[model samples]
Target: MNMNESFQTLNFLPRGKFKVELVPGVSKTNFLSICYGALTTIGLLTFISYSTNYVLLENLAYERSQIGTIVGNLQVIAEIVLLSIFLPIGLIADKIGRRQVYSFGMLTMGLAYFLYPLATGIAELTVYRVIYAIGMGTATGMLGTVTADYPQNHTRGKMIAVTGILNATGVIIVSLFFARLPKTFADMGFDQITAGKYSMWIVAATCVITAVVVALGLQKGTPTEEQKKIPYLKQIKAGLAEGRKPRIQLVYASAFVARADLVIIGTFLVLWGTMAGKDMGMTTAEAQSAARIVFVTSSMSALVASPIIGYLIDKVDRIKAVSFCMAIAAAGYLSMFFINDVLSPDVKPLFVLLGVGHQCAFFAATTLLGQEAPKMKRGAIVGVFNLAGAAGILISTGIGGKIYDVIGPYAPFVLIGFCNIAVSLFAIYVSKTSPDVKEA
Candidate 1:
């Protein structure tokens, strides 16, 4: 279907009301799958981004620099765990079905979250983080591949944007309700550890609920007859062979940068903002609130930007579109350099800019991968896609954590900003040299 028709028929909005529309040719089955995917995305991302970043990690280490290092280490370890299992899980999903792998990951996550509050120190926390990473490894790989499975090529970006919206909404919901729940418990005279654990248990419950929904609601697709004929090893070899192409190379590059964007922001941004608030004489509760505001502002901005960016992805060249988004992200991260206080009004614009920029890059990259990778081998390709992302998280956060402590609070952002600019230029070069762009 055409873009205009896709928009008009996707939803049943009254007159000019703003509401999300379904993509064209969406069956009741496809619609249910999308809805369940959104719901699952909401639960998982909320736990990963909001509950953990905004709430749990902050209290783990008292020293600001120590917290930075610890958070960085957590990411490093988790990504390593994710990297180890991602390819195998992808292969398994392709061999059997995505639904089982996807739902099983959620179950792993729920178990990990339940253990999070039980940790007595950094070492125990690291163990829990690894468990969570295992879940993340399996679930995230499937989520991307399955999402690509559902959308028509023309509407892939829009479908991704809808999930992005759900992700943002998840962040907002957890930020508003769960991020503050610990503080609420503290206000009621609970001890710090108790208050935090209670909040985490709530997230754990959500994970369980989401897992059940996914296991029941998500459907398995019949592999194409051609796909059925290929050996698993041949599929793996083909997926790796595609990596030598310039477009696939670019997508890998995008994965490295894009995966770390939110992680750095979610983990360190909270660390900086909360520490800054404490420096300004705010209590722990107040500081956390300030950090939540930062998280919420960025999420809300991304929420607003997702659909618009999705539309742009449909109309523009994916390479050029990603380059533009990277440019915006670079500008946003660079602007943060000038803000002396994390809570300053000056930071909101930067948050919005970063949000829009990052989300755009995210969808553009996903859409490109969806377009470029053959359907039969998509799960394997997406496995590699996530491996690159995991590596990005590992390298950037590992160095960024140290950078946060050694160079300055703004150092990590500065480093990533430069990387974004460099990548943006690389994308332009690819656009100039690459032909048959639509195939990618």
Candidate 2:
């Protein structure tokens, strides 16, 4: 059968109103698989931050004071690895296929997880983290590339919103269930070490299964005739040159702060809550559970707000939408200064705000990038975008971790908050001076 016939056969699939007008050759089946991949890949990646703390305290016997520095260093290492390879990975995806790269990434993550629980020291753990970073950069790079590839220009914001909702859902499920597995096993009469090992093994298995799904479910081969005709190095140069556009510069800036926001919440927020729970005389398992509650609150808020933010993105000038999103993010992250206790019920509202802001900023950045990136050079352009994000992670985690240990846990959030405000102002400037040209 022809591609049209295959798509017609799958027409009964439901993707809601927002998913209308897919680009040619992208069926509802491909869209569904993309959504599921979003759910699992991000869910598993975010859970790593939460679970790493458990391993440090329970399995490695690290002190609370040292944990911040160690986690920071580990993230720095991962980002460094990502910095080196994100562009090449994107070029490879453009040449071979997104599914092959994406599938291999998932399988690599599974390998890292299988080795994670077997670490006897920080050195071993650090090595495993580098392996994990390779998978993360590969999978997430494809995620961004495909997200941009699947939709017509008009439906871009809604597609991003759907994926954003699934991303939040993944985080919630992983935090609530997968993150809690170690504690559950401990409660079931396993030792701390054994529980952590078993939990990681289960996640490792899940990653392998997800790899299989991605390999089979996603659309096969390169995306466009134009891409195939271009020489490889010229594609790289074209992607880099596109950054000269003011709107593209704004998207890159948004990516920097937006990525940092995610890592801060995943790393510092949970660490703060976990430490607070321990101070109250809770066991490591109990403390982790409490931290997960706070983490879940933020993810739940993101889930609720995604469709609304997405709708607004589709309706407004995307640059203006980015400014609005950064404004909300500024408000949320700056609000962290007011919270004296992360574990208190009164702080739930603040966490909710953080969630909404985080989701909005990410959706805004991604949607804007989707709108601006050229179709033929989309993968390479997305790599640069992710490279900017990697730089953000490097700085935020490298410095934020130190300040989190020295100044206060609230310091990291406040630092990124000011960044959000700065980007918001920049977005406003770009909107006035360099508005997007109307698409023909």
Cα lDDT, all candidates: 0.75, 0.88
What's the TM-score of every candidate structure?
Answer: 0.91, 0.96
lDDT of each residue in 1-440, candidate 2, tens digit only: 12245452222235444443577788767877888899899889887886689889987999989988888899999999999989999999998889999999999999998899888999999999999999989999988888888878887888788789899999999989988887899999999888888988899899888888888888888897557677879989998998998988998999999988999999999899999999999988889888999999999999999988988899999999999999999999999999999999999999999999999999999999988888887888899999999999999999998998898999999999999999999999999999855341
Model 2 quality (TM-score): 0.96
lDDT of 1 by residue, 1-440 (tens): 22244332343234523333433344455556656656555435544544444344445645654767767887899989988887778777877777788888888888888888787677887888889988877777877877777666766777677777777787777777777877898899987777877878887888777777767666554345456567878878988998988888888888888877877777778778778887888766667777888878887898998878877787788888878888887887777778777788866888888777778767777888887887777878888998898898899889998988888888788777887888799889888888466442
RMSD to truth, every model: 3.4, 2.7
Alpha carbon RMSD to native, model 2:
2.7
In model 2, pairs of residues that clash are none
- Model 2, residue 281: distance off in Å is 1.5
Lowest lDDT sum, 10 consecutive residues, model 1, at 1-10
Whole-model lDDT, candidate 2?
A: 0.88
